[model samples]
Target: MAAPMKFHSLADKIVRTRVSSTLNKDVKQFGKKHLFDGDEETCWNSDQGSPQWIILEFSESLSVSQLDIQFQGGFVGKSCWVEAVKSGEESFARIHSFFPQDINQTQVFPLPDTDSTLTSLKIVFDSSTDFFGRITIYKLDVLGAS
Candidate 1:
């Protein structure tokens, strides 16, 4: 068997961020912060809508080599694309697109080699497993050297 892929965690470098919508206006409940809090019970829930997106900014440029996530079965994103941009760049480059299974399990997606100068990453959920297009994510980790 082959060895593990890029396994470093760069989560601490995450700075500013934006999301399409949260489950509630309350930050204490189902807020965007819960997306990376590493708590199994807490999750970032999106409102019922298609084409949801999450943009994450890092303190410095980075190259995202892997994506680790846990989705709540029925509310998972059926198909999604990940994009990244270098600092001072006007356009973002599509890094990878994937289809996640409709199950509550941590899934790891290895991304292609990217420019280390990338300062921002965005994930667009083109479709959802749920009929209403809502998404529930228990954990989301962008991995690679910081």
Candidate 2:
């Protein structure tokens, strides 16, 4: 059997910042404060309810084996969608989506094969009620590759 691919931390791979709120001066300023050079920004209405998202972009290609999403509170929707994109030009593809029963709790998602390369990462909100109201993520850790 092939040995497991090595994993790396995404602590330094943050390349851009995106939120679900209206793009006002505050949001733009927030982007300027968090996003890196050549990063993209966008917003989406939550079909479920009030939505929140944290999008990250890696600087280099790496083998992603696991993903750790650390947030302050829990979500209200039935499930959340995690997406990845190979390049800024490519459209985001769904990686994982699931419902959580807990609130105000930290969540961890173990990814599938996910050998695919990613330049950007996004967390989608899917809920009926705005439990958290807005998704706020403190940090994201992508495991695999340096």
Candidate 3:
């Protein structure tokens, strides 16, 4: 094909990403697709539970530089782990860990060393700001290239 078109937002055309849970399937309010739709109003709200996760896979190995995320204030992934499965690796590596504050604003995480010439990228939510353990991800755009 045409080299798959170099992408800026890795989640833009997600074909193989996996999510732990979605808040409501019937209302179509909080599905995982909203995480990268480039819309601030939409989001992926995980069901009430701890340790929720989302795995974003690439068509091939690609370089990742950073992560831009927006989370709902009260329902944030407070303690989280960012992992990656590299080009030749079989197991996922714990590339980074972060603690997102409880605020409804865009948070930028520059993975300067975390390159993701990766086979897949994963985000595991170890804890949430919400008492019910919910996570609402407003945006999930990865700055990367093929």
Q: What is the C-alpha RMSD of each candidate to the true structure, in Å?
A: 2.2, 6.6, 5.2
Q: Lowest summed-lDDT stretch of 10 residues in model 1?
A: 2-11
Clashes in each model (backbone N, CA, C under 3 Å)?
A: 0, 6, 0
Report the lDDT of model 2 for residue 88. 39
Better of 2 and 3 by TM-score: 3
**Residue 29 in candidate 1 has what lDDT?**
90
Q: Give all TM-scores, in the order shown.
A: 0.91, 0.62, 0.86
**Model 3 regions lying over 4 Å from their true place:** 1-7, 112-116
Off by over 4 Å in 1: 1-6
Tens digit of per-residue lDDT, candidate 2, span 3-30 = 8666766656665565555333454444
Sliding window of 10 residues with minimal summed lDDT for model 2:
38-47
lDDT of 2: 0.55
lDDT of candidate 3 over 37-145, digit per residue (tens) = 7887888988888889999888878788778889989998888888998888998989988888788889977674653378788989999989999888888888775
**Under the 3 Å rule for N, CA and C atoms, how many clashes does model 3 have?**
0
User: In candidate 3, what residue range of length 10 has the lowest lDDT sum?
Assistant: 5-14
